[model samples]
Structures are given as structure tokens and as C-alpha cells.
Target: MGHRLADTSSPARLAAPDEGIGRDELALATRNHGLPLEALRYDVTPPGLHYVLTHYDIPYVPDDTAWRLSVTGRVQRPLHLDLADLKGFPQVTTRVTLECAGNGRALLTPRPVSQPWLVEAVGTAEWTGVPLRLLLAAAGVDADAVDVVFTGADHGVERGVEQDYQRSLPIDVATGTEPEVLVAHAMNGAPLPPQHGRPLRLIVPGWYGMAHVKWLREVAVTDAPFTGFQQSVAYRLRQESGEEGEPVTRIVPRALLVPPGFPDFMSRARVVRPGTVPLEGRAWSGRAPVTRVDVSTDAGRTWREAELEPDDGRPWAWRRWHFGWTAAEGEYELSARATDAEGHTQPLQQPWNRGGFANNLVQRVPVLCLAKEG
Candidate 1:
């Protein structure tokens, strides 16, 4: 299926001033035209309405008839699978949440560096495709294979590096039984939008968005770890000026409280009547299932356990959580934190890294508890 381009007339496509746009201005422009940065605040983000953030301005639309996914490198039998060939495999469907590695970059204390994302860089979708392991197994991975590098059709010069978008994972993780990584061709039961990986994409369940290569065209098994710019430079977190911190992976445990939209202010900052209110949002983790979620009305000074919805059995999907709060006339800082099955909980304050990646700090929203009107 061919992909459709986003309407150029959208507010996000407004031209910059003659003086040229600064980082802040560019961020605002993109936010207006691109996906809303606060999309996860809703109960279920519709697939068609899901947020879209691309590294390159133009999205690649491949002709389905001519498109093929190549598997080469350290494989015993290299193979090229067309769209129909890929669909012919035993297919699986799953609901997985994907968050940008730099989801909270805008909230970092040292000011902005990369995309100024204020936590709206995530969404959950039902993905349908063939298991990546099936393809790797068919190709017969070499005994010495170490990493599987996934390459996208999109290409652009980022930070002076002219290259196609690519990222790699250890062979075991790429073909792991759990999380069920996929060479996805459909999102939410439909052919993926161009903004997403259209003809094909790799869905690395439970990992950050960067690991899920869009516009996928090639899957290469390498004997050595791939050191592509996206892997070696861009997505890796760094501390200080020169220290290589660590490669960012997995979705950190986190919970977001959907705010009651207040009049005359952002919906996220709402005024509520002094009474009992239902607090709801979604919580997720990459390492394990979200076992517990806590809500705090007075910041982090105290917290109470929130009820967790039953897991959907997809290890990669997020859980819906809810808490009931009795409010009084006052101003309060509401916050939510989630704990995963592995005993890891969202921190009140996430330490800053040079790249501002993986900021899973507990989300805090301001609320005004007002008396009932009339």
C-alpha cells in the first residue's frame, strides 16, 4: 500500500521567518504541525491519530510491488522476502508501546539539546507481522554472529554524518522468545502509515522507539557489533563532555496521570471541584510487567498504591492504572510512579545525562482543588 503525506497546510508546516529559526522556534513549529507531545494522556491512542516524529522531513513511500526485505551478512542462506512472502509466514499480532529514546529531553535541567520532547513521544499500537526470528532462522544465522543490524529506507545527514537510519541488537535479543520482535508490515490491523515504517519496519517490543527501525529494507547479521552512527553516536547516552555513558534500551518504568482539563488553562493543568475524582493513566516497563503503580497528591512526600488493570498478556504492552482521590479546596501537585515486576520503580528525579536520553522521572501535574460552583 502507498503512503500518504501529511498535509503541508497544517500549522506545523508554517515557514520560518527570514532570519532563520532558532531551536526553540523550530520546536514550536514542529509541535504545531507534528504529533502532540502529550498524546499518552489519553486512555487509548487511536492508531490513525497516533503521534508521528521522523528523523527526516520527508517520509519514504516504497512501491509495494517492488519492495523487498533483504537478509544478508553472516547468514548461511541469504534471502529476500517481498511483502507477500513476508505475510505468508505464520503471522502474529501484538499490542506494544513505543516511546522515543529522548521522550523527556525538553524537561532536562541543562536546557535542550536534541528534539525538545515533553513526554508526548509515545503510543501503543496493535502490530501485525512475522516474527524476526523466523526470518533469521530461515536465513540460518552464522555461528559467530554477534549483532543483527536493521537498516531503514530513510536517509539524511544528521550531525554531519550522512547515512541511512540504522540500529542493532545482540543476536539473542533480536531473536528472543519473549517480547516477540517482529518485521511489522501493519499497525493497528492496517498497512502502516508512511510516517510509521510503511512497507516494513522492525518492532523491538519493550525497547525504545529508536530500536524499532522504520522503513525497513534490510536485516543484516554481523559477526561483530555494528557501529553505525545511530548506534555509536546519536542514541547512546553520554555523561560529562566525553564519557560514553551507555546505550539506551528498554522502556523505563513510568506512570502518567491523565489530568482533568481545567478551564482557561492547559487541559493538563485543570481546576477540579473539591470531591472524589478518578485518577487514571497508563504505566509500562521494558524489563518486566508493571506490577504496581503509586499516586501522590502532595508531590512525593507521600504515595498510595493505585489499582493496576489486568495485563493483556503481551509482555511488551502497557497496563492501565487508576486511583481514586478525595480532593479538598487547595492547590496540589499530583504525581504518579510505577514499579515493574523486577522491583524497579520510577525515580522521583532522574539523573541528567549529556544526551538527555531515558528521562523516566515521575510525572507531576499541577491541579487546583476548587469548591463546587453555585
Candidate 2:
């Protein structure tokens, strides 16, 4: 056998230039980012820092002639649409929060086995597009269809295996709802950047990032299950039983379980001296709108209800809340739980799975106490 590895540092890199945007800038953007709560019900999502989830290193901006969305598979009339054709329909927009199912995975203990993401991995944005249902209806989608498969223009190799990021939704998820779903061509208030699926992408709000396939190039309606790598092998939960089998690989709704008061989950480098710190965070749900957010400073022994903001649009957006307590001189554990409108309360700990999908357990933060500043 030849040498197992070659010199590593000299390999070609397709990485984009720094673009003068550093991690600190991104962090600040995330920290200060705000959604127009009043605009949540509208179709236009607010422009900047709209949540983005992508599998490609850079967005592919195709020329107008090169951009085509194919509607094939089980349709009575197969259709191919260009950018102008999609724009001809009366455009609609809605302010929706697009969250990565893996958002906040870094906060889990034992590190929960996946991407190291902080709170910023998710975002809310107003997406404008032609409702996919309209297009599918125009093409006369078959009644026997089971799933809607979406593919994009980006492709690459991972672990020496060629793969392109794509996703599928159940027929119920794809065509059941009004404004049904979207083949989004615009994000926020501007044309999508080349790095952000300029021509088209899918915007299926409330589901995990996997549901919102980007760089959309094709839409196929099928009666059979889509068992591709991105769907079957990658974004699935692994069972601890260690049996050679496929785990349940579908999107399940999860709620953002925020405690009454914000607890710092980790040490802060910004604080020179520590004192009583005020805490605040946001809570949300997918199954139902969050009704009550509870806080527990004494490790779930005693609980208090935090003040909750009025409902924005029922179940589509997160409600913000606040909690405050005097910092005592010692180490403390802080935690939060959320209850949905249907009386579904968040669990203290969610079960762990192999692929670590949808881990929305109650959020806990560790805080430190310090002497009063002189």
C-alpha cells in the first residue's frame, strides 16, 4: 500500500474571501437583530439578518436563461418555469421564522454530536414568492402523490461521496395549507444574493431547516418515498440500540423551551465584575402557540410565571419574556420551560438520538456569583 495520506496544507481551497465580515460582526448582528413583530402577519419579511440555512459553501447565481424550475414526476402536465414566469403571478409575502433544527446544539451537554452552533443559527424573514401550490395546481398534480421532492443547483462531494443537498415534504405538508407553500425568489426586501439562492428556493416555515430546500432547480411530485442520502442517511436520528437499520427520518415539530428569566449558559468575557444580572429570553412552539413560560431558579423546586408578550400571530412566532433575580454569592443553575396553547409543557430533558435531530429540551444555563463591586 502507498502512503495513506499526502501533504495536507497545499490542497486547493474554494473558500470565499473574508468579505470583511468577521465572526464578531456576525455575532453582533445576531445579538442586535430584531424582527418586526407587528409585521409578522404580512407577506413581506423584514430585510436584514433574515434567518438563512444553506448546505452550499457559496450561493449559485444563475443567468436568467440558465434558471429553470422543472415540475415533473406525477403531474398531468409537466412544467418548466423561468424567473419571469414565476414573477408573473401576484406575489405574496409572510414574516416567518426559519429555524435550523440543529440550532443551539452546542449548548447541549456531552455536546450532543453535531454542528457547533450558537443561538444565531436561526432567523426570521419575510419571504416573497409564488405559492408552490399555485404552480402545482396549474400543472395538475396527481391525487396519488405522496411527497414533493425539491432539488437545487449546488453540488459537491462529502467524505469522497458526491451529493447535492435536497429535501422532500409529505403531501399534507406540501399542498395542504393556504398560501400553501412557496418557491421563494426574494428574501427580506431585496433580490436574493448569489450566496442566498438568487433565482429560487423553498420556504416551508415552522419545519426544520431540512424542509426549506435552497437553490431550487426542480420540483418533482412522487407517489413513492424519496430515500436519497440527504433525506434517509444524513438528517436522521440514530437509535442507541446499535442495530443496523434506518431510524425514523421525518420532521417533528419542536418548541423553544425558554425559562421565565434568562440565565447565562456560559461565562461572559465582557463582565469585569459580577453582580445581580437581569435575565431575558424568547419562547416558542411548533405544535401550538406558547401560552405560558415558566422559570425555575432553584433547579425546578419552585416555579414562577414570567410576563409574556401578547400573541403575535398565534403559533408562527416566538413570544419574548423576562425574569430577574438578585445574584447570590455562589454558583447557580438556571433553567426554563415552555407550555403550548394546547397545554403541552416542555420536558426537562429531551431524549438523545444518534443523528441528534430536533433536540428541543428545556434550556439550562450555568451562572457564577461574585462579590459586590467596590
Candidate 3:
């Protein structure tokens, strides 16, 4: 099917200068240029429109200098790896979707306190780098270690608190084969542009972006879980199931249960005669494949199946599904919810969390009916 987004000349701003870019400047780029990012997973987000969330004002790590990836802390053999050292190890490439932990938080009710993201807060890329386990194996992880801490070079002020960016992954996910983790030196086959964490960045293919720290300068193999601000204060999800709510500090790995992509017009709205339109949208599940996508027209009163695109078991990619319905002269609401193969359906509304992480509310895009003019 043909895309509805404008041509390449439309100013999408993926590789533009940061002069006019503001806290929310990317919105225009997403709406104007069909984000050119490819899903690499089932969702198929184009490469150019991937969302970037950073703590610093953007750090540029030069290519000429000899860069190093240090593995310190509790390892038996603390190691420092230069680019050549990393290259000397076996090279692995995996296509995985990377999404901000707070990707869909903007859609939450009462609005969480975090960066407001319109739907474009994620992207997938073919990451080529050395396996994280290989480095850990060389470092000889201590038998009693509990976690591995990753720190990046991006620095910024959060609520007047100046801090270096850091986060941790459990030793299991950090060392597993399915994680397909990388100390990526390149993104989409180029020395990663500085804005996108140049030189070296951690790429945990199936996990959220928080685990894939960019511009990674140091990786500490630790005996205990990390307590960095990004982990303790930010990216913490309020645990609420049915009625009880508690806060857990340990970072839990999240999967792309719902695929990422634009919404489809399930049915056309008509303010005049004979003007018909098509409905489309995207769905994904991080832990499992999306089994079905349900569309609603009369505000949850009636349900219908939207056509789902065939999917392979690619981690973090979204599925594109669509349905077509007739238009009538009236106001209507358009919404979608995805059910994973495991039967975890998106809630009509996700709960409010202090840090605004892991929000997977049913997606709704509003459209108005207007009369055609001659």
C-alpha cells in the first residue's frame, strides 16, 4: 500500500542542526514528513523519524580520537576497551526496536510529569556491535554480582539536579542471547551521528531505550543494583494492577507488546455527500506478537476487527492494521486497542505514574467531519 505522508522534500528534520529544535519541536517533523524510519521489527518505523530523548544538550564524540569502553566495578579483570578492541571481538547485527520508556505517556489521563511525546517517540535500527556478554566474559564477572550499571556521556540538569546519565539491567537480561545486546559503534551502517550517541552506545535490541544508553563511556559490573537518578527517580513505573498500587525501584524490562506506527482511519466521517476516506493504524506487543486489533467507532459501544498486517517475531516492531467504514454526517470518535497473543489487551486508559513510564493506553486519534467546497 502507498504511504500518505509527504515526499522527502518535506522538512522532517532527522539530521538537521539543533539550532531551532526545542523541547517539543519534533512534532512538526513527525506530522509533516512520514517518519522515514523502518520498523526493523513488525511495526516498521522509518529510520529518519525515530524519536530522541536525551538528558544533555547533545554530546558530540569525535571519531578521530581513540574512544574507550571501560568495564569496571566488581569484575575479576576490570577492562578498558578501545574501538579496535571492540572490533577485534566477533561482530553481531540485530534489528530491534528501541522506544523511550515514556514513549506513550503523553496519552495518559491526568498527564504524567515527563517529556510530552506525540506518537513518534520510538524507532528501530540494525545495530552492529560486539556482544555485551563477550565483554563481560572477558571481564570475568564476580560470582556474587547482582547487576550491571551503564553510564553515558550525556549530562543535563533535571529539576535543578545536575547529573550524569545512567541506568542498570539485571544480570540475566544483560547476559542473555535473546537480548542480543551490543556496544554499538554504528547505527544503520554509519558511524553513529553525534546526536544519536556517536562513538559507542549500548543497544539492547528487545528492551526499552532506557537500557540502550547512548554515548556510553563506562559500563560497571556491580555486586548490587544501581541507584542512579535516572533509575531511582526517573523511569520508575507505579505498579497498579486492578486496584493496588505500589512503587518498585528495580527496572523491569518491557517489551513491545503493541507495534508502533500511525493510526488508520477505520471509518470515514462525512459532513457532505460522496466524500469517502480510508482508516488505518499500527499495533505491537513487546513480549509477544499482536493477535488482533480492535477498532471502535461509537465510543466503545460497537467493536470491529481491523485488518492486521502479517508479522514475524521481530522484537519491538509495530504491526500496521486497517479497517474501512462508511461516513455519515455527524461527530464520531476513532480509537484502537491491541490484544497480544498472550491475551494482554491495552487498557482503555492507563493509570497515572509519577515518572510516566510503561504507559500503554489505547490509542485515540480524533478527526472532524467537514463539508466539501467547490
Candidate rank order under lDDT: 1, 3, 2
The alpha-carbon root-mean-square deviation between model 3 and the true structure, to one decimal in Å, is 10.5
Candidate 1: residue 129 lDDT (0-100): 96
State every prediction's TM-score relative to the real structure: 0.89, 0.75, 0.76
lDDT of 3 at 176: 81
lDDT of each: 0.79, 0.62, 0.64
Worst lDDT window (10 residues) for model 3? 7-16
TM-score of 1: 0.89
| Model 2, TM vs. native | 0.75
Off by over 4 Å in 1: 1-21, 24-44, 261-268
Clashes of 3: 33
Per-residue alpha-carbon lDDT of candidate 2 for residues 1-374, written as tens digits (9 for 90 to 100): 56322322122111233333345335534443333222333333445544454454555464756788999999999998898899997787866656666655554554443344544454556678988888888888898999889987778643344667777887777876632578888877677766557778887755666777778889999999887767766666665424334533222333332222233435431121255455555666655667787777676778788777786663455666667666666666666777876777766676555455566666555555656666
Question: Which consecutive 10 residues in model 2 have the weakest lDDT in total?
Answer: 7-16
TM-score leaderboard ranking:
1, 3, 2
